[model samples]
Target: MKPKCGIVYNGHLQSDKFMVQLHWLSDTAKRHGFEPELIGNHRLIPAVIDGRCTLLGPYADYRPDFFFFWDKDIRLARHLEKMGFRLFNSASSIEICDDKSRTYEVLAEHGVTMPKTVTGPLLYEGFELEDVSSVPSIVAELGLPLVLKEAYGSFGEQVYLIASEEELIGRLKSLGAKPYVLQELVASSYGRDVRINVVGGEAAAAMLRRSETDFRANVTAGGRMFPYEPTDEEKAFAVRCAELVGADFAGVDLLFGPDGEPVLCEINSNAHFKNIFDCTGVDLAEAMFRYIRSVLYAADGSRKGDAPC
Candidate 1:
């Protein structure tokens, strides 16, 4: 019997990009002899009671052997896990990657090389910064023209470049008590960065994102993508970064250091692959499915061993 799997996506997000991802993943699953069902989070309700998960609605009794978690709905992912559905990236991995501050804490503990970052204090409602005096000292430590990023954001949407003490303070005040990160801006990597797709503990494809107009090199921010050949050291660094985060597949962004060495920028567990596909013509869904089969069905629809790579 062909193994059945579910490709979980954010159903409420009605976008072509989301549909494109589903199409690619479902097509790949079909080619690999697996029955792929598109599970939209909006239509499906995961009812939990006393540490038990029950499915309600169209998939009331249907259960898949595995799940390809392509959404950021962490609670739903966890609920599925509790119901014995194995998630590719896992719920814990998604949670960590969803928050930049937590991502930094995890990677730093593993000694991953990255820019110096300071996690900001969380601001609650009806509260303000009690000590505004430390703002200058933080600027002094990270220097001028630092990068400010919200802990929870995607597609470089909530990132800012603060050039002066006044600008930094102003932006900080505007941000209020939201969790953020202040980091040293790597001058060499301005308007440029490398994104490597790592799957099954190896680097598969890489693309260089460059933008002359915006400091952020995200393609969504009007950046251009060019095929990149990563050095062995650079590839190793990216692979290690993904492994540390326990991501079965990830898009790891690496920034160029002052001496041209690679430093970790960020890791995306549910990375959008449309740009990488257009640039490299490498179908990420195919690679992901291959990895899933090797790990989940190497022996009779159950993981063969502890070997994740």
Candidate 2:
């Protein structure tokens, strides 16, 4: 019998932008000889019941050999892991990638090269920042035209450029107790960066993202895409970042340093690959499937012939 693969996705985020990838994943799983089941995040309930942890919901009875967790619902992802289900891009990796601040700290601890960053404090109590004393020191360190990013965000929507102290304060005031990070701006990579998709510890595909009108080079923000050939340094750097985060598959964004070196931006555990596919004509879902199959084989060595891919 073929191994059952659960393709878990967020139910709330149902727009085409989100749904398109799920379809691709599901289709690829079938072609790769697995029984693919699309499970909604809401439908798979993990809870505490009868003095023991329980998975209770409409789809509670259904269990897959493994899960492709495709959402940032950290709580749910962790619960699935606790229930003894193996997750691609493990729960811890997803949590780290979901929060940019955590991503930086983990990478930096291992001496990975990236921008100079200062992570802001967490204010979980109220909606007001009681003190503004640290603002000056942050400004002094990063200087004007620094990058301010909310710790937890995606698609460059929560990232901003502070060109002045006033603008910086304005942005922080609006943030109001949310966790954030301030980093030195790589002027050389102002409106351009490279998105490298890594699968199974290898650089699968890459593209250059450039924006003439915005500092963030995300396609959602009107950036143009062009095929990019990564240097050995970039390929190794990106692969290292993905490995450090424990992601089975990931998209690593790299900024161009002054000397054409690669600087880390952030890593995405469940990176949206439709954009990369459109840009590079590489189907990441297929790559991911192959990797997962190999992973299952490496785990037990008994599934080598189970519905062979």
Worst 10 residues of 2 by lDDT: 300-309
lDDT, each prediction:
0.89, 0.88
Residue 303's lDDT within candidate 1 is 48
lDDT tens string, model 2, 129-183?
A: 6677888888898888899999988888889989988788888888987899999
Q: What is candidate 1's lDDT per residue for 166-185, written digit by digit as tens?
A: 88778888888788999999
Candidate 1, 140: how far from true, in Å?
Answer: 1.0
Candidate 1 yields a Cα-based lDDT of: 0.89
Q: In candidate 2, which residue pairs get closer than 3 Å at backbone N, Cα or C atoms, i.e. clash? A: none
Error of 2 at 204 (Å): 0.5
